[model samples]
Target: MSSFSSLFTRRKNKNRGRTSEKEIYDQEGIPKHYDRKLDRNLCSIQELFKQTTDYEEIHIKVGDLKGCVCYLGTTLNKSELNMQVLEPLREAFKQPETDAHRDLDYLREAFFPAVSYEYAETLHQLVWQMLNGYAVVMIDEHSKALALNIGGTDKRSISEPSTQTIIRGPKEGFIEDINTNIGLIRKKIKSPRLVFEDFRVGSDSNTKLSIGYMKGIVNEDILSEVKLRINKINASGILDTGNVEEFITDETFTFFPLIYNSERPDSISGNILEGKIAILLDGSPFVLIVPSVFTDFFQSTEDYYQPFFMTSFIRIIRYVSFMITLTFPSLYVAITTYHHELMPTPLLINIQSQREGVPFPAVIEILMMELTFEVLREAGVRMPRAVGQTLSIVGALVIGQAAVEAGLVSNVLVVIVAFSAIASFVSPIYNFSIAARLIRFILIIMAASLGLYGILLSLIVMVIHLVSLRTFGIPYLTPVAPFKLKDQSDVFVRVPIWGDRYRPSYLMTKAPVKNKDSSRPSSPDQNTGGKKEND
Candidate 1:
């Protein structure tokens, strides 16, 4: 204990001088210019990457030029290094008096045939590139090094989206690689108007992220707002899009998610077509779409793929389910505790019979059941997939049966809780589903205190809160509270594709009409030309 305490004390003293001159030099970040001497550059890099066990340095000679290459073994592909850098340089040096090997520029232009390479004169540039999986080539007399992009291709293969499953839409999903994710979007749009702006967040982590939007279609002001919010993120490590979302969201205290995110590439492509901007993070599969409204969460990519009638029915069901998920437990508590007369006599008698021997009040019973279900859901998510599903099913059955048989919770409450759970699952977006789940508890508390009137009060408060919310300055309840009739075509009920001509009015898209030439096809009518081949 004494040794540990002393060690901690020493660490605190070391950090106490964190603002001192030497510490500032270390943390003030990499130098803008590289040292003219190769040995100096090598020494500084070696010290900087002292803790990196995979740091590798190799010595090589090129036509009387002495130099070294530094890179992280774990990050750079050795095969690429041998083929693109080592082999070419070795062959060039073998030519006794080759002028091409004398200069770094000639070496890169004539000798090394790498697809992409950049000159880095500054230590800051070299360090950043090296950290991002580039190999730094340091020539003896040259003031700069060739930063070859030899980043390893060690990422997960593209697979079907685990979440946001669909029946008739594209099977592809976004992976953790930002470039791959961008490529997926590109494959869908293929338009020259699509623009992706790159930004690096996290001062220490330096996580790369990109913002994609249609140049001519997206609102310029909204794009500017998105950039401003992203630039304002000053955190040291942005682990995922969730961190970025929180930093850039309009409201921090609200239960609802202001920015919508998805793992589906088609969903992102659809959002971009609608003039929304997508933010892709380097290490997260979920890409965030900005200026999301409440209606956006209820709709899915499948809605556009299927027939209008079928999609519209499913969309309406989603909205209905959302309401039930958010208010069912509260409604049950309110009706039983205070609004008993509002229920049908037969239903009331049935509920009373189930609750006959239950000792807890309606509020307690509802809370208990809700908590149990929430625990089961969370367990199913956290546990191993093989065991999770089976465990949750068996656990729910056992716990529910035991609770009901022991008269701890009524059978009617179990039915209500199950319905609420199922309804919550109906939301297309997981983040939105979480928001609904959390809001359900608040409504339950309100109902317990003030009954149906409490539920009404909570509803009014929630609606007002949602109305006040904004995503990148666009109202959350867009086309609903603001009431734009044209945008209503795909809000609650999806109209035919041809009729959804204009983009959402709130977006103020530069190009309003999605497809001006789009029109429904008509069958040929029976006429003289169609009369009969015999005539």
Candidate 2:
């Protein structure tokens, strides 16, 4: 019995590092005698891992001379590893086979053959890998650890964008996936000159941002400036591109959007062809187009899809709608209150009759009705869809009818408010509609304070603000401010496709001349049917 005990103790000592038997027995060996006391605490890999409940599939294998323990959470790509290493080893142990050739390399080749891996020794890399959804493999007596890619799928499918809808253009919209978004853009613009530059922002989040442009066509200085501004963003989190845009925008307080946001890949591709830089965020459907001039707001994707004559007429109407939305009510108020001499006698008489028996002054009545309409608009948006429609119809009918009977607001003021609301809705972009609403209130206040003089003052201030504003260093009111006649063909009225031979000068495009004069089609009458005087 003493010989058998001695042999077992020798084997145990051989398995561990050399240490004095006295120290081993006293400090490390199992306790021989105790007074009904609990076993002394011992350090182990299992105890270390048991502290965390996150890793449920961690596997530990004990062998004769060496051992291995890996968190099952790490080796995800190695389905074969789970099968070959775990299953085979379990079966081997179940049977009584002592095949002593289970080394680290042997196990690796058997399970994960030809698989590439990187060693991560530092805690920083290990934690980063784990957070990025990698599996970590540890081997006994080796400080280096293996990291395997095993990220889970959690991406949303691409769908049409809620905003920036087009009637005649492509129905596809940018998705949350960065790679898919890039592919969409690439699919539209097949040119090799199209360049996509990637940038990593958000110090903690490391969100990926991509800047796309045509290589030679895009202005180098402008691209440099854009890249510089993007790199300057020092936020902790960037959930969407708006975060980066807000951080880098020249005027944060201004109501106007300096950068144009669009979801249509074709629009972005068109902007790129025009030498503009497009910024795409990882998780946002909207891509930001820089150097957006005032004319861009008036332009729509349908303009290119339809006949130029029809597009030009629509463009003119949009411009007219913009003016009507902004100043129609204020102008009405100003003329009625202070500039009645400008109005014809018949119209003046009609307005006077409409305001008769109204207890409130014209300005007061306008203010009251405008405020009520704005409140209703907000309520319609905040309430549920079914309730929202009911509220909008009921609210408009009840308030409008009640106001007429109560004499708090004139029927004329109500008409003006309703017309202005409808006009504001004509704006193609929702964000621009918001700006229109705000500016309408400003114009109303100006008209009330100083009549026509106040209206003129507001117009001058607005024009100056617009003139001073720059979208990515390009003047907001371009071609108009710079007085470029060539680009004017597509400005107020979109010219026929044949007549649109030049690109906008503000973009500084390399090929401003779209096609040569020789490419112009000659009429058959002029070519062959002319000069029959000899007969």
Q: For each candidate, what is the lDDT? A: 0.85, 0.70
- For residues 246-313, could you state the per-residue lDDT of candidate 1 as single tens digits? 98888899988888899999899999999999999999999999889889899898898999999999
Give stretches of model 2 more than 4 Å off: 1-126, 129-152, 498-501, 510-535
lDDT of 2 by residue, 399-431 (tens): 999999987777777887888889887767777
- 10 residues in a row with least lDDT, candidate 2: 34-43
On TM-score, the candidate that comes out on top is 1
Question: Who wins the lDDT comparison?
Answer: 1
Estimate candidate 1's alpha-carbon lDDT, on a 0 to 1 scale.
0.85
